[model samples]
Every structure is written in C-alpha cells, then in structure tokens.
Target: MIKYEIPETLKEHENIIKRTFRYSNEIIFKCEETKPWESKLGGCPYLKNIEEYPVDEEGEPMLFLAQINLSDLEKLDDLPQKGLLQFFVVNDDMFGLESPIVVKYIEDYEENEAQLIKENPYEDNEGYKQSLPFSNNGKMYFETREMPISSSLELFETLFKDELSEEEYEKLSRDCYSCNSRVGGYPYFVQHDCLGFDDEDFLLLQLDIDDECGIMFGDSGNCVFSIPKDALKNKDFSKVIYDWQCC
Candidate 1:
C-alpha cells in the first residue's frame, strides 16, 4: 500500500488531466487495519479462505487487483489539500505473486534517451529476473495512482521549499528520505511531456532487504522525490534512482 502527504499548495490547483490506457485492470485500496474479503465472483480458489488469514501488523493487507472495475483515477477533484493519501492495489488474480515497488527520478538531460533503456536494464542485467521462480508468460498487470493538477504545486514545494545550505545539500546528495513510507518523488516533466509513462512509471516506496547496508526498508513506503539534473549540484540526497516492480 502507498501513503503520502498532500502539501498545502496543491489544494488550489484548478485543472487535472488523464490519458486512456490500452487496458483497464481492476484494483482496490484498503486500510491497514482492514481484512481481505473473498471474491463473490468465485474466481481464484487460492483465496477461498482469505478471511482466515492472519493480519499483518507491520502494515496492511496485500492489495491485489480487484475483480470489480474501478476508474484508474479516483476522486481526483476532491482530494484534501493537506492530508495523507494511503492507496494500494488489491488484485486476487495476482495474489502471492512477486511484486516490488520501484521509485526513480528521470533526469531531464536524458530527455532524448529511449524510455525503455532508462526504465529497465533489459540487456545489461538479468539479475532481477534470475531470482524469480515463475514465468508470467507474456502478460502483466499495472495500476497507476493518478496525480491531480495539485501535484504540480506539491512537486514545486518538494523541489524548492527550503533553500538548502551548501553543506546540507552535500548530505542530501548522498541519499534520499521520505517521512511517509508510501510516498516518493519524480520530476515535473513526467506529468506533461511524458506520454505512455503511466504504463511504465508509478510513484512507489521501497524497502531494501539486504542486511549489510543498515538501511531500513519499508520505514519509507514507495514515495518519490522528483529531482532534476540541476538539483544535483546543490542537493544533498543520493543520485541513485530506484526502478522497482512487484510482479
């Protein structure tokens, strides 16, 4: 599940936009304290006893794709100007499948770069896929958390809010952090010029599982912090942008 803060600036935006997708997948978001329910449609037998499953105290229920059709973007016009939006996907069809939330910042300098190469290391690395035990065949499902017009203002606040001192910017250049586990940042251009991005990019928080690094995973969910190449000169966060997927 994803959760994030809505900055005060975004509450005043007057317009929002959306692009149609090749397919519409059903999905749902549930509170961390809620339980999963069995599908009344009678599909996916593995979830027959889903009601008896133990609750996850660490977070919330596994949000799978819902059987019921849902608008890819919901309540865009009514989001609170300043509150937490915790959203997740519930799809029983892909229940128990491998999924990882990936967060990455697109460099404006890479504007001319092929989108696929920037997003996935299809040729250079098979390491991510080596660990997977099952083949999804050729089918994949994706759901995007639609951004409202207010996002532009929120992003502006995130990128320029507090002027960073040279020393502080140096530290920020070394790593990225988010107070909310489920939120992340991305560049402003992604909202405008980047078409077909919905199928490839989504804001997600991540937890690195390796123990050697001492970094706490899931302490911050898949939320993105949008940074541009110029910000690199004065920013204190790390240069690494994560590309994550859970299927």
Candidate 2:
C-alpha cells in the first residue's frame, strides 16, 4: 500500500515502482514492556519447567531470542492458528549461526505466569544478555508495504540505467529499503545475496540490528529465518533455515 504521496523524483516510474518492489503483509514487532511469559525479545521464556528449556550442543543453556504468541497475531495467511513459537540461540560470538539453534512450538499454552520458568537459565551471561530486550518484548502489529529489497536492487537499477555507478546506486537506494523487525513479509538484508532463501521459502522472522534494544548482529547485520510455505501452513517449523548478514 503505497498510500503516501510518492516522492517527487520517483513518481515518474509509478508502474515500474509497483513492479520493481514486491508488497506483502508484514507483522511488525512493536516492543513494549511486558511480563516474562508474554511475547517478547528477551527475559525468561514461558516454559513448563527448567527441563523444558532448550540447551546448546555443549549442554549450555541457550539465550532467549524471541517468543511469538500465535494467538496474538490474527488474520495472517500463513501463520499457525494458535500456539507459541519460541526462538533460542546459543551464547557465542556467532550466536548459534554455526551451532545448533532452537525453535520451540507449544500447541497448548500455560496461562499461569508463576508456573512458567522465571529464572534466567544462562545467568552467567547477564552482562551479555543486556543486548536483548529484557524489559520489553515485541507486540505484533500489521501493515502492507513495498520496498526495494536488497536482492532486487539490480532490477530497480535496470529500469533506469543499464548499470549504475557505485555512488549512483548508493544514492538512488538511500533510505529506500525496509529494515523493519517483522514476520511473514519481504526481508531486508545488509548484503545483497541470500543464498538460503528461494521461491518456495517464506520469511518466517527477521530481527534487524536495533540500537534501541541494544541488539546487534555483527556490525549492523540482520538475523532472519525462512521456512517453506507449505510447512508454515502445517505449523511445521522444524526445518527453518537461519541466516544473517552485515554490510
């Protein structure tokens, strides 16, 4: 929904603008102060017990990355109807990019806040965990938008010039791409190439580097996960591909 008046410079290529950028429904994560069991980026998760918490290959407790309460999000075309999907990654320099990452799904949830795990599992990383949002978590909100995604940068240029100089490309694309933290939409990448994703894949989650939350992924990088469209419909998150990149 390009509802806003187009920029004076880009209004000339309105049709190409529509075709160059793909618009999709996106659920933006609006960070807000919340309880531990609520959907959030950090803090302890809603686990039945400490045993239910996911650990890394070395048996170290993984850090809380994010938790999505499917019930909170409504009217999505390819989201689980009702459940809790939690994301956890090991505490390391790579943040489980190479190591085994964890994604948990709970069809039935526990509403009792006191019954859930409250104590942080990786207490040793208290200082490091500061990078995550311990006080607030993301609240899901929706919008329809189109932007020049990194992968389509060249296509956007082709419409105007055969090839743009480095300076021209940077200038033309300045502030034109999206860098929103969202689920189920076109992705934003610091790097142009995303080898792990393809046509059959759907953007499951994307957490962009945020200074407000003190979250960073290797110098302004973005962490993203993608799953097959069919799998998403079936609520199968077992084979998600996790990837991240920086400028």
Candidate 3:
C-alpha cells in the first residue's frame, strides 16, 4: 500500500466538488444547445458550440437530441483537479483471460459461492489439490443520483446541424465515457473483476495516489494500497493502493 497526506487546502475543495455534485444539489438552470457536428461524441461538450446539426449516412438531418440539465457544471471551476483517466482491462494471453473483465459488488456470501464456481470452472480441484477461491467481481457500484456535468445541456434550436459520421461518432463516444468516469480530486476505490490466473499470475497496477488510491477483492474485501505496509504505522486518511492473491 502507498500512503500520502491530503493537503488541508485540497480537502476543502474536494468537499465542495462532492457536495455540489451530490444528489441533493439544486439545479439552477436548464437550456438546450445543438451539439455541433464537430462536437458529436467529443469528451468536453462545454468547450465548443455545435457548428452543424447531425445527419444519417444518407445525408439526412438526424433529429436525435439529448435533454440535459445545465446546473451540473456551474461550479466546475471550484474543483481542485479535473481530468479523465482511462481505466480499462487488458487480457493477458499468457494467463489466458479476456479483456474488460466485469467487476461485481458482492452482497451475499452463500449465494455468490455457487455462482462463482459456475462462472469460473478453474476453481474446481482434485483430491490433495486445493481449490482456488472465486474472484469477488461484483462488490462495487456507484449511485448516479443526478446527471453528470457534461450531460446537463438540454435540447435547443440548431442553426447548423449535421449527422456525425460513424467513425467520428464512435471515437467521440469512447472519449466521452472516459471523461465521465474520471476521478475529480477525491479519494475513490474501484474494484475490477479478476482475470483468470495461474499460480504465478499477478497484476501490475499503476496507482495515482494524488488522485485516488486502493483496490479491493474477495470475501474479506481486503483493500490493497500503493503505500508500503510498514509506512502505515501512523497516518490519518493515508491514501494507499495494494494487491493480493490467495495462497
């Protein structure tokens, strides 16, 4: 695990951003604006105006409009740190696993035990050979009580609207998702579904403690931090990241 002290200045700003984006935050405005043809699928929607309306492959104007709330990004400037980090899983063929593994939030122990064995056959063992424990893939979920900042713009009359090309739209969508999942100057923990592993397979994770720390797994839900274990002797809210596997 890794540990770092949260500067007092950053703590207040962090709290402000959390409270502003909270479920109870008041919506002060609602307006509509055309997503410029160039802005279609882009990550930062607030930075540019729609130049042309969107259209289909046949060159017809597409009438797909999103209803968004405007107050979500009103106080964005107050956020301490703002940027998106792409969090994705890469399959390791040497270990034999698929990409983008699903991470689940474990709620029931008894029910999950049977389901784990069914989903992961590798956990089965013969006499004298111990069975590997199932990975706790479903133990984390976020409650999006309110709309995100980027999606707050409501539908408006468009002077220049054109359909976005398929390739352009796909790239924009990916970038949009990446930005939405970004960690905003706060400490958060995200649990990923474990990949298939042999006795020696392990994870090589790069943690950004200044932004977020820690990953958890299993029934005990042991949290691994980036800070060394010995360094946690005395610290308050010491951010850390860690990794662990069953023996």
Question: Residue-wise lDDT of candidate 3 within 7-64, one digit each (tens)?
Answer: 3433433342233232212211112222211111111112112332232344432221
Better of 2 and 3 by lDDT: 2
Residues 142-231 of candidate 1: C-alpha lDDT, one tens digit per residue = 243323222223433354346444544334322222222222232222122222222223332222222222222133212122223333
Off by over 4 Å in 3: 1-118, 126-141, 145-247
TM-score of each: 0.21, 0.75, 0.17
Model 3 TM-score on a 0 to 1 scale: 0.17
Highest TM-score scorer:
2
Q: Would you give me the overall lDDT of model 2?
A: 0.64
**Candidate-wise lDDT, in order:** 0.25, 0.64, 0.22
What is candidate 2's lDDT per residue for 119-235, written digit by digit as tens?
566654665565442334444455665554433334444554544456544555664566767666456767764544544567767787654455567777878877888887777
Worst 10 residues of 1 by lDDT: 34-43
For residue 226, model 3's alpha carbon misses the true position, in angstroms, by: 11
In candidate 1, stretches whose alpha carbon ends up further than 4 angstroms from where it belongs are: 1-165, 174-202, 210-242, 245-247
